[model samples]
Target: MTLLRRLIRLLCGTDPVLRRMLKYWAATCVLYVACIGMLLVQVELGLSNPAAANGLIAFGGCGAFAFYLLIRANARLKLEPDQLAVAQAVFSLVCAFWAYAISGPLRAAMLIMAVVIIVFCMFALRPRQTLVLSAVAIAGMGATMWWLQAHDPVRFPPATEALTFGYLAGALLSTALLSGEMSKLRSRLKRQKRELTEALETIRLLATVDELTSLVNRRHMNEVLKAEERRQAAGADTCIALLDIDFFKQVNDQHGHAVGDSVLRCFAAAARASLREGDVLARWGGEEFLLLLPDAAPGDARAVLERMAERVHAMLVPGLDGRRISFSAGLATRRAGEPFADAISRADKALYQAKESGRARIVLA
Candidate 1:
C-alpha cells in the first residue's frame, strides 16, 4: 500500500488539488475498465446473456465518459466557492441514487462507493456545503427507496427489502459522521496551510532585510540594482547615491555598537523620509547605504542627499546618549548608456571626496 501511495505521488505533482483530481480520475478510469473486463469475462463463462452483458459494458462505457468529463471540468474550471458547492451537491445525489439502483453484492459495493464519494466530498467541500450535501444524500436516498417499494414489489424480495432499508439507514448514519469529522479536518488543514505560507514569506523577508536597520540588505541590494539598471536602460533617467556614516568607528568607540546600530537605524529613517516614492534605499554594507533615485538628475540627487545628510546630522539618537549621527553622501547621475556598477563606483569615489574634504557633507561625482 505504501509503495502504491508513493507511486501515485510520483505520478502526480505536489499541488494538493491537482494531485487529488488526477488520482480521482485515474482511479475512476481503472474502475470502469475493470468493470467492463469483468462483464466480458462473465459473458465468456455463459453466466449472462450476450445482450445483458453488452448493455452492462455500454453502461460502463457511458460512466467512463462522465468521469472523463468530470476530469476535464476539473482541469478547465477555476472552481469558485459556489461552483464547488454545486458540484458537491450533484455528486452526493449521484452516489445515493447509484447505491439504491444496484442489487446483492453489487448493491453492497455501491453503498461503499457512495460512502467513499461522500467522504471525499466532505473533505474537499466547505463545511456548509458538506452539511447541505449530506442532508441531500440522506433525504434523497430514503425518499427514493420509499418510492421504489411503493411503486414496485416484484423487483425486490422480503429479504432484499429489509436489506435495502438497512443499507439506506447505515449509509445516512455513516455519511453524517464522516461529514462532521472531515469538515473539522478540512478547516484544520486550511488553517495550517495559511500559517505555513505566511511563515515562509516572513522568513524570506527576513533574509532580504537588515535586522538592525530594517533596510534592504546587501544581497537584496544587488537584485534592486539589476532591476534599476533595466529600468534606466529602458530610457528612464535615474541616479545612484552612496551614503556612509561619518567616523562610524569613532562613534562605536566613544559610545557602543548598540548606540552605533541605533545611529544607523536613525540614519536609515531619515534617508527614507527624504526619498521620493520611486526611490529605492538599501543597506549596501556596514555603515554604508545605497539609494537608487529614479527620474532624478544630478542636481536633484545632490539636493535630496544633502537634505538627508543634514536631517541625520540634526536628529538626536535616544540610545546614543542624546548624541546626533552624521553621514557623508556621494551623488552621481546615470550617464547615458552607462552600467549600474560604473555609476555606483563613481558615486562611491565621490563619497570618498566628501570624507576627504570634511565629514558630514555631500559630493557630486
Candidate 2:
C-alpha cells in the first residue's frame, strides 16, 4: 500500500483530478486486456472471424502500447483531466469502428461501448462538450452503418438498418443526458468542497492567530501552557516568560494608537527573530506576550528573553524617531508536577518586580 501511494504521488503529484484520471486509465487498460482475452477465447473455440479477430487483437495491442506511453509521459505532458477524457473518447470511437467492422451479429453491442465513452466524458467535460461528443459518436456509427449497407446490402436491409440506427441513437442521447446531469452535480460538489475547506482554514486562523501581530493568540498559548505543564510533570524542561512592553500606553498617548500598534508588531518580530526554532511566541494580551521555551533551563530561558529585549531595543519601533522600544519580562521554569497556573502566577509576580524596579529588565522566578 505504501509503495502504491509513492507510485501514485510520483505519477500524479497531489492533483486529485490527475489521481482520478489515473484510475480511469487503469480501468480502461484492464478493459482492453479483457477484450483481447475474449477475442483469443473466441479464436480457440473456432467461433470467430479469424481475419476480423486478428485485426482487433492487433489494434488492441497498439492501443495498449500507446496508453502505456501516455502514462509514462504523464509528468511531461501534464494533461488536464478534460484533455485525457477527450483522448479516451477518440480512442473509444476508433475501437467502436473496429468492433463494428469485425462483429457481424454483435455490431449493436459495440454501440454500447460508445455510450460508455460518452458517459465517461460527462465526468470531465462540460454539458455542451458531452452533447457534442455524443453527436460525434452517433455520426461515426451512422457512417459505419452506411458503409456496411453499401457493402453488404443483404445483411443490412433498409428497414432493419433504420430501426437499428434509431435504437442506437436513442440510447446514446439518453446516456448523454443522464451523464450530463451527473457531471453538473459532480462539479457543484467539488466547488462546494473547496469553498468549505477554505472557510475552515480561515476560521482556524482567526481563532488561533492575532490579527495585528500574526502571532498565536492567548487562547492557543493557554493550550500550549497546559500541554507543557503535562510534559514538565514528566520530568521535561519547560520554561515560560511573560513579556510586557515597557511604557506601551505612553507610546499610544504620545504618538497615537497607530504607532503603538507598530511598536507591538516590531516587538513581536524582534522577539520571533531572537528565539530559537522550537520556541513558541504568542500575544498574551494587549502589549503583553508569552514565550514558551521547551527543553530549556532557567538560565537558558533568561538568555533567550534577554536577547529578545536586546533585539527590540536595537531595532527601535517604527515612527518612534530612534526611541528604543524596551520590554520587561518575567521568566519561570516549570517545576515537576506543578500546575501551570501556579507557574504563571509566580511569573506575574516577577514581572511586577521587574516593572517596579524601573522596568527594562528580566526577573527570574
Candidate 3:
C-alpha cells in the first residue's frame, strides 16, 4: 500500500497531457496482448504450417510493438505533428512493401493503409511537404513493383492493367476526399478551442469584479491583499490606502439608496480614472474602498492619497437630496517584515483618525 501510494503521487506530478498518454498506452497494451492471443489460437487451429504461421505472428507482434514505441516517443517528447506524420508515412510505405511480398490481398490492404497515411500527412504536415512525400511514396512503390516483375518475369507476371488502374484510382480518390475533410475538421477544432478559452477568461473576470463600481469585490480584494503581502515579504515595497464617503449614511437616509448607489459608482469611476495605471483598486465593503500600491514608498503613497482626497472633495455629485457629496481617506505603508493583517489594521486605525479629525482629509499611519 505504501509503494502504491508513492507511485500514485509520482504519476500525479507529471503534466496532464503526459498522464493521459500513460493511461492510454497502458490500456492499449492490454488490448494488444489480448488480440495477439486470439491470433495465436487461429494459427494453431487453422494453419497447416504452424511454424510459418507462428513466425508471421511474431513479425506482426514486433511491428505492433514498434508502432507503440513510436507513439510513446511522440507523446513523451511532445513531438510536432509534422515530425510524427513523416515518421508514420515512412512506416506505412515500408509495411506496404513487406505486405506486397506476402500476398495479393495483404498488399491491397497495405495500399489502403498507405492512403490513410496520405490523409494524416495532409492534415498534419505542410501542404507542400505532403505533396512531395505522396509523390515520393508513389514513385518508390511503382519502382519496387517493376523491379520485382523484371526479376521474376515468369513467376510474377505484371499485375493486370485493369487491376493496377483500379488500385491507383481508388487510392487517389480516397486520399483527396478524406484528407480534405480531416483538414477542415482540424481547423474547426482549433477555432472552437480558442473560443472556449476566451469564454472561460471572461467568466473568471466577471466573477471577481463588482458590476456596479467596476472594482474588485470584497472577496477578490481580500485575495489581492494577501497576494500583495507575499510580494512585500519578498522585498517589494507596498502601501495601502482606504477611502470612505463622508455622510454616506446620511445621504442614503435623506435621498434614497438608489441615488447613494449612483454616487458610489460615480466616485469609483473618478477614482479609477485619476489613479496611476499600476494601482489596484477594490471595493473593500459598504462605502469603503481600498487601494493596494506595489512598489510605493510611504511618502509617495501619502502624496497620491492626498491628491485623490482633494479630487474627491472638489467633485460635486448630486446626493439623495440634490446636495454635494465628498469623502475622506487614510494612507498606510507596510512596515518591513510586517504581517499583512497588521498593515490593514494600521490603515483602518488611520482611517478612523481621519474621520475623527474631520470628514475631508488624508491621514497617514
TM-score of each model, in listed order: 0.61, 0.85, 0.53
CA lDDT of each prediction against the hidden true structure? 0.72, 0.82, 0.69
| TM-score, prediction 1 | 0.61
lDDT of 3 by residue, 28-107 (tens): 34644664464456555652245644555576567656655665566567776466557656755665554454443234
Whose TM-score is higher: candidate 2's or candidate 3's?
2
Model 2 per-residue lDDT tens digits across residues 1-365: 59999886786668675566667877787877777776677667765688889987887778766865676577789876677678777886888777776666656677777777787677678888888888888888888888888888887676777788899899888987887788778889999999999999999999999999999999988888777766667645888788899999989999999999999888888889999888999999999888889999888888898888779889966688888889998888877777778878888989999999999999998
Q: List the residue pairs that clash in candidate 1.
A: none
Q: Which runs of model 2 end up more than 4 angstroms from their true locations?
A: 1-22, 33-48, 74-84, 126-129, 177-181
Clashes of 1: 0
Clash number for candidate 2: 0
The candidate maximizing lDDT is 2
For model 3, name the residue pairs that clash. Answer: none
Measured by TM-score, the strongest candidate is: 2
